[model samples]
Target: MSSVIGKRCVCRVEVSRVEWNFLHPWQRTPQSKSTGTAFVIEGKKLLTNAHVVRSATDIRIRPHGSTRRYPAEVLYFGPDFDLALLKIKGEQEEIDFFAENGKDHICSSGKEPDAKRKKFLHGLQFATDLPALHESVHVVGFPTGGNTICVTEGVVSRIDFLGFSKSLMLTIQIDAAINPGNSGGPALNSEGLVTGVAFSTKSHKKNQPLSNIGYLIPIDIVKNFLGRCQENPSTYALSPIIPYRFHSLENKSLRLAHAVPDTVEGVLLTSVCDSMKGFLAKGDVLTGIDDRKVSNDGQVQLRGDETIQHGYLLRGKFLDEQVRFSVFRNGEHVISSPAVLRYIPTICPRWESVDYFPDYLILGTVVLLPMSTYLQCQKGCGTRLSASTTNWCQKWPHEWEGKEGLVVLTEMFSHEVCFGYNRPYWRFVETYNDIPIKCLAHLRDLWEESMEQAKESDDRNGDSNSAKTFSFVRLGLEHSDDIVFEVRAAIQAQADILKQQHIPCPSNITQSNPRYKS
Candidate 1:
């Protein structure tokens, strides 16, 4: 175990800084330094945790024992997976190090390396197959900025779903002691091959200290992620199709006026990729796939397998594969075949000067910040009415009842629309244009209509100098000051209506609510 600890590990990474505000409203204090790690598989590219470089103003990667540091930048990121790819300049020393110790080299050197090539290969190669559960493992990285690479020894505790990232095969649970500085570091099997990237840990509660429950991003997923990056550097940042955010819509009793029982029961196709068009369109209620009947809740029941989400059944397959969807469109049950797309549509996390808010456009802009049981654990606090305003765009806990209300997490600023409205974190939006808002597709239509009206108004007024504005009607506890009664009554009325309609709602809300069952 000691021999497997640090000898074969070489992670390409940097030191990063993150800032969180404890006091002082709306102000991010200063930079807090944290260790970051990245490693290459198959010489394609690098991998690290999304949190490792989150909101980082500076990033500098240096080899374990080297004084020289190289500037690195983000290549791609899947927030849902908590993984990011980094692009760095290949210097002589770095290339030599990678050639010697990293995964099997795929890059062509201008000149051939003779058997006696003097490359200073520093990293260990990744193993081809996954290690069995309970296999001994070692982790290596510069945690807390020490003189040399720090190493921790443990064993794989679990190797199924981690229920964190939406990407398939993205996580691994280990008893290895992962610390704040150990994030993005490489986890190694006893054979000295890289296995996973260390990411998160369970927190200690009162009277209950946490144990070795560290999680890792499996090397296999990273390998797949890197391959995509290397193949297309320009679009490497784009993610594959897999959604982290999805709400159940198997309402049999609350069917639309003409929607049939089958249409009412299957999962509602609430949203699709913003960039990925033609593959999936919003409002297409998926009733079945590949000839299998999708349960009303958007799940596909297999012969003896556990009922799984239809999307999960489509996991790991490529775009262009013919997927038959039995969808209920406009009260008609139709089989729609959407083309497979490699690129996932997403709102770039980094804000851009644009007209559409990403998720809100797909789901309705009217939403409540998720106040589920899972959200509360992250914020380390209980639900308070005013907390949403202060923590807008900042991480906080939220609580809620079943289908409850829609919560807004992020909003894109497009033109002058929604200009005066402050983005509130964890705030719930109940309606749009007086209609009960449920998801992203509903919001997109509302926004489009508003834009059209604004355009018409401007045209009729012949005012070229003035820009028309659209109002984003939102109902929530945040506006409890002005529309307190209205929001409360709406909540109660909605609850009663849903109960009367026999619509199934979530039993409890938590950050873990949307997470996949491990």
Candidate 2:
């Protein structure tokens, strides 16, 4: 197939972004410029990798060989699958964007091809089915070498692969020349139909990055994502989560502990998903799912000969779908039943939140907010979370005591009341005034109650030695001593502390605040 079709539908994405600074929630990181690729899709929309436009402030799209740069906006972004759907900011029913009429596309010559001899592609079409191993493919994008659309040929080296966030998505591995600027481009097959989207490669790895080994969001997952996106435009539409977390029963000792026999070949349940509430337990060993036998290494055969992780078998399963499982529980071969799939989130919240602005709380010189998954996502985005606390933020969904979050004292500064106490930076606030602190909202409530008590109980009292006259708040922490401060002094310094720090408000207790919904 000619590269002309690719040049017609594909585009050069120019993004300028001012990324957020997790440590300094009030400020954004410096602006930066990057280029990638995208292709025209249905309904006047474009599709590209989510990371390409992440935190983007200004976005422009330049069609191949064209001087016009059209402004675009993100319609929907899916960080889990590394995809984003975009639409031109202006121009409704603008057919000229993809026009083949007297337009010089990809050809440097200032002449358009003869009308009867030319062809135009309205949009890139999905391949009817995925390509096979050793199938030749083309990668079209504006990579680092030059701005022109570069086409590289490669073969489908492997299939049914997974990457990033342990996403368990069906991916494609190719031996292609994928570079920095090639991200978000289309991977087309022999018939010029897009088989996948070139999203990432191994060259960005820290230790020993290599070239010629790139990955693609296979058509299977691509179609699945688009199918859901079509149901609800401009929303982070999601399918139901794979309803199980299994650990390999490869260790004989571990298997014996679960009272499993040598004849049994299955994976141990690290934690049962809440979606399967009463049907399964944490210690139960899963022998099979959907009637397919799982090996001790937690693999199941798919597509006849292809063997993939047990989780892959659950891919693309949407809401209300029944998942039958064969289980081993309580020293017997029991617990075989099906459970309906539901949208249950992991213990940690997803990073693709609609809330772009993070919430913050200021108490005197100390700054606080709830710990979130951002601690993990932005690898180099600096934060004060300790190693153990950071690890706990990555847990799967499970039953836990108390509330579901940790109120972290992220920042501490010099102040009269904060002088003698140990700096409680990044430590979980376990209690306030002998009352358990559940979340930032709860902490705000307790602060209000403490202030009301001070005003009514002791502002008029003459005896400073009375217990009621002790206007101080004690905050207990995990693995640290209590942080005690005089409530009156903190209140007096609150205005100055906030003013000097340039903080917007004393407390933005929830991420769901409509003010930060954008």
Q: TM-scores for all candidates?
A: 0.52, 0.86
lDDT of 2 by residue, 30-147 (tens): 9999999998875667899988998899999888878778888887776667888888886642456656312545456756555433444546778878788899999998899888
lDDT of each: 0.51, 0.73
Q: Candidate 1: minimum summed lDDT over ten consecutive residues — where?
A: 351-360
Which lDDT tens digits does candidate 1 get at residues 174-292?
A: 88778776788888887667888788786667645378788887776666655555555555333445532234564445455335554255666555544334534666666676678
Best by lDDT: 2
What is the number of residue pairs that collide in model 1?
Answer: 34
Report the C-alpha displacement of residue 334, candidate 1, in angstroms. 14
Which candidate tops TM-score?
A: 2
| RMSD for each of the candidates | 14.0, 4.4
Clashes of each: 34, 0
Query: Residue 103 error for model 1, in Å?
Result: 18
Clashing pairs in 2: none
